[model samples]
Target chain A: MASGILLIPGPIVISENVQKALGTPSVSHTSPEFVDLFASTLQKTRQLFQAGESAQPLIVAGSGTLGWDMAASNLIEPGAKVLVLSTGFFSDSFAECLQTYGAHVDKLTAPLGGVVPLSDIRKTLGGQKYEMIVITHVDTSTAVLSDVKSISEVVKNVSPDTLITVDGVCSIGCEEFAFDAWGIDYALSASQKAIGCPPGLSISVLSSRAIEVALNRKSQSSFFASFKKWIPIMQNYEQSKAAYFATPAVQLVNALNVSIGEILEQGLEARIAKHHATSDWFKNKLRTEKGLKLVSSNQRVSAHGLTAVYVKKPAEAISALKKKGIIIAGGIHKDIKGEYIRVGHMGESACNDSLCHIQLCYEALSELEL
Target chain B: MASGILLIPGPIVISENVQKALGTPSVSHTSPEFVDLFASTLQKTRQLFQAGESAQPLIVAGSGTLGWDMAASNLIEPGAKVLVLSTGFFSDSFAECLQTYGAHVDKLTAPLGGVVPLSDIRKTLGGQKYEMIVITHVDTSTAVLSDVKSISEVVKNVSPDTLITVDGVCSIGCEEFAFDAWGIDYALSASQKAIGCPPGLSISVLSSRAIEVALNRKSQSSFFASFKKWIPIMQNYEQSKAAYFATPAVQLVNALNVSIGEILEQGLEARIAKHHATSDWFKNKLRTEKGLKLVSSNQRVSAHGLTAVYVKKPAEAISALKKKGIIIAGGIHKDIKGEYIRVGHMGESACNDSLCHIQLCYEALSELEL
Candidate 1:
């Protein structure tokens, strides 16, 4: 096991109980106990997304990228047009994933460290009909937060048929999201990130309409990611029935269940508040005390889970922080790839005031001359 | 953690070391420590597959089903004719997966608990040229092992250009396999089963020829499973360089590394021999002492990892074993779905004699009047 505080966007610091859950002995996926646990986990996933009873949750054995593939394969058939709100590297990748599945992609590039304006999205939607609209809730590459609720509202007004999809890989657990109220058709995240679990399972929640769109698609191009193949299996598991389409990541699912339980037990509203407060403090310290420019442009648009800061020498700063037992990430955004560094303050690290993970990271980073 | 012994085909008993590895602290995928460890794990995977240095191993975050997607998306172009040797349910699923990617699949299904005839395969190859041929090394549904080496030899003789692929989901670690010697182009497996790791990673080793086919394919329809995107990332990782296509399952990979190390430490030949011995003893007891028929046609074709025995009441037998704190699986083969029960005797359970997992399972089944 690699040590030191992991301050990357993800796979972030996992809590002790979640870690213990990950190491659980192997169990039959079909066993009644596992089925019940799985059912609860799926329901917990729905809660994590703040989704209602009509929504369906899918927890598959894959990274967050598989979620992109699922959306591409299930929602967009060949010749379909998709509008991608590109915040940074991850959004660009999602667009690429869609193209791979034969979707005609139109990208609305956000300004560096900023989100695509709602006006621009509405204008684009008015000009052309899109099968889907993708929004990166918080792009890890830039730490830029998109206003998903506003974006969905714009899409709903301009093109009611356009399915609103949120790439919540970075935002889901820590950020405030209301699936029903926000009118999100589909959203996806991973186990790692703010969920505080190992990086294996791709957790997605789909609106009933989105599920219907997936089910009624003309052709399913991919089998493993095909929603048609997975929906019934997920429905079966959620109903505490044994069903198998593909073997699930049982241990990872167990870990996710534990982490989601902890997330809910602490309460989502309080957890989101803690993350926001942590982000505010850390960003304030970086801007005022350290005199550093953040990549998110402004506090209002910045993601609460993480922050990207411009560094004079990112590699040197990273190495220096490593010496202090702090692990941070270098830049990944293509336009400013080598110009900044990122620090994550979410999950147990941000929620638990006693851990002082954010404080430790700030202190270590302050020591860096870069 | 769901307790009791897990005797299912995949997601079998994970060793203590492997479980400990699974709970490892969060690590950056790009960190030197993790990169080096991942590179080492990839090398160990090559050894596990018994492949030459020319072969490449992919350890992606997914279930064994994702392996089929990889093969379908990477190797088979749309409208390409592919031959699927159907041993049981898994083979049929593999065929379905290939067809989902627009492949024209020709399934050569064997009789219940039987292997496809070599002469029939030769005749099929002689009748039409195929782009690929898929063989299920061990169809978990029936516990019937295919003669991969012999089949690969026949493919080489009849249609040298046809890529030979093996589904080693239930066979990899426990069964005797020689990637290079058998002239197999691609072989895919899972972290669970004989690997004795958690059920998350989809592991595959591809020959240079298979890589060429993937890279030179006309158009890639799938993004997550596409080798075009993964190959470069895998190459960079193998060279101990940081390159990201998607976030890896860090903890699962760590556990897989530990498990692979254990497998190598035990020696593949001895491990295979041990599984064979265990399977022979258990199967003989079922047939001779208990007077029960096996789903497998004969001893020669039975898989070493698991056994499927025909029982009067599979559900009753399974419930009875569950009561004794031993978990086994009911048959899944479509034809004899509920007539037989499966007991996995692979990994630590079968290899570690002192555990007597197989003996306990046998005794539990013996106690069942059904």
Candidate 2:
């Protein structure tokens, strides 16, 4: 039934190899073959974040939102101060998640279609003794890309002891991330989006420091996402040993293994550049040729994975594109809920030149007169 | 790599149709087509549980363990007393999850390879007023089955106000369940077990009373598994309206849609009966013909979904069966973990006569000296 070209921000088009892996017949999660695959996939997940051997990667069965919960539950104890750099709906939700775990949250929201300024972050960090600072690398709602590297630098300089976390749900596979080099304590993403797999696995990478902090936490508040429970299991899996806390989503892990292999095969730098190039090409076409306004304020801050443009009639444009067999998403940011349409150019759409998915979307939009 | 007759207690062999569904191409979670499919799948999930219209079914992207987190985080507030009827590892883990969420858990563990008696449950209920009583319908580790109807009746008679919850992760599709008739307040399962789908989706059904209790919680503790956030979204999706809290695993949901349809097509009664027949046949062959002892003390309390049996050396038997192209699980009950093996007989292996998977497993086990 999902016949059309899917262009959603996440749950983007999956590759053929990934789909085949998804259909793999029942394999015991504890089997040697699965263990080897899972081990390799965990290592590859580190590579996706540009992380080193010291960094630990976790692939659990949940959406990207679960990553936020994991970070909140494992890292932030009650009454701990956390600064959230809010770019859009996702960042706000991340703040809400921290608050849910009893973290004292201070949100620094950017203007509509822009990121929170580095100066504002520095000032906020200076004002408080925070346990952690969260930055969304790319907020899907606004298609706004925050500069994680710069923000991490600010956190390191202004509040050296604070843990720097990144919500890379929409950025990890399609954008530049150097987990070790950038001094990021933790970052999380999903299997879909730029990873080109179906949505299920919540992928994340944590520096050794983050893991140590989690290990030494005074109180533990989670079970499924508990670092105490999962850390050893992940370590054992990385060593190709069978260890079970809860049952892993076997097929999704297999699919992720295949997808991450493809990503590594293409190389992350080239893949990220391809997404940027495609984003530039499509955004140029929409702005200059089609006379459209983007939800992202400028190319400097725009995300490479998706384009959120303010259309005259967002719903009508989406319907028209749907009729032409090109599926796109409508606005999700509360302020611009019905004001724009989002077209994802990540995964196969951006990486596979022969697919021409972005061109198809552009042509469909040309027909819509939006 | 998974080539064999997979006989693990859960993550059992999936059917061809379910595998095909799992490999479905990318689809937007918010698309009309996916929404409609999801709506139908939700209804089918209700049917899978034999639940009434007043019940709400939630299919989230996680393992069955997340269901315990959801139930604990949403229904049990801090300091609330909960009685966990522990049959084995899974039930003990469920109690841990409740305790993690700040619930005051009182565990009543049964003997090895046996279920907690209804009389014990009744006495426990009479001793203290509990906010909820947790039961594992079938503990995969021990292959012990708890009579949910009788247990629920006992709870109803002793403590009518207490919520009755069932962890049916290893039981649902292959075992008899009458949600309304059994007066089950909440029941949770995973797709990989009896449902014949790849592992990813955490499926749960909650009665109106359970929903009310969840909604009425004084303080919410979770962000990802929160009932408050998911309730409206589920309601909207069930009505074929697009609503988003967190992204759904589109492919997993599609596979579940098809699997549940097949489960309903065969009829729950027939499907469940087939599992019982298969279990009886296999257990009889193991006990009488093969001269092996089962972990389950008697046939009455043995689970129909899987068989846990004692062997001279479980690891050797598992390896010997593996050499003959059959995959059986090593025991996981903490006490007899090394002495026995577990053979899953659910879904296609149990219900589809054409598969002959159970027979293959029997023949393979017969070859083993253990």
lDDT, candidate 2, B1-370, per-residue tens: 4657888887888878888988879788888888999999999999999998999999999999999999999987888999999888889889989998889999998888777888888898999999999999998889999888899999999999999899999999988999989999999999999998888889999999999988887787899999989888899999889998888999889889888898899988988988889999999999999988888888888999999999898899888888888888998888887898998998888988888999988888888787
- How large is the i-RMS for each model, in angstroms? 0.8, 1.1
Q: How well is candidate 1 docked (DockQ)?
A: 0.88
- For residues B118-202, could you state the per-residue lDDT of candidate 1 as single tens digits? 9999999999999999999999999999999899989999999999999999999999999999999999999988998999999
- List ranges where model 1 is wrong by over 4 Å: none
Clashing pairs in 2: none
TM-score of each: 0.99, 0.99
**Structure candidate 1, residue pairs in collision:** none
Docking class of 2: high
Off by over 4 Å in 2: none
Top candidate, metric lDDT: 1
Go through the candidates in order and give each one's C-alpha lDDT. Answer: 0.92, 0.90
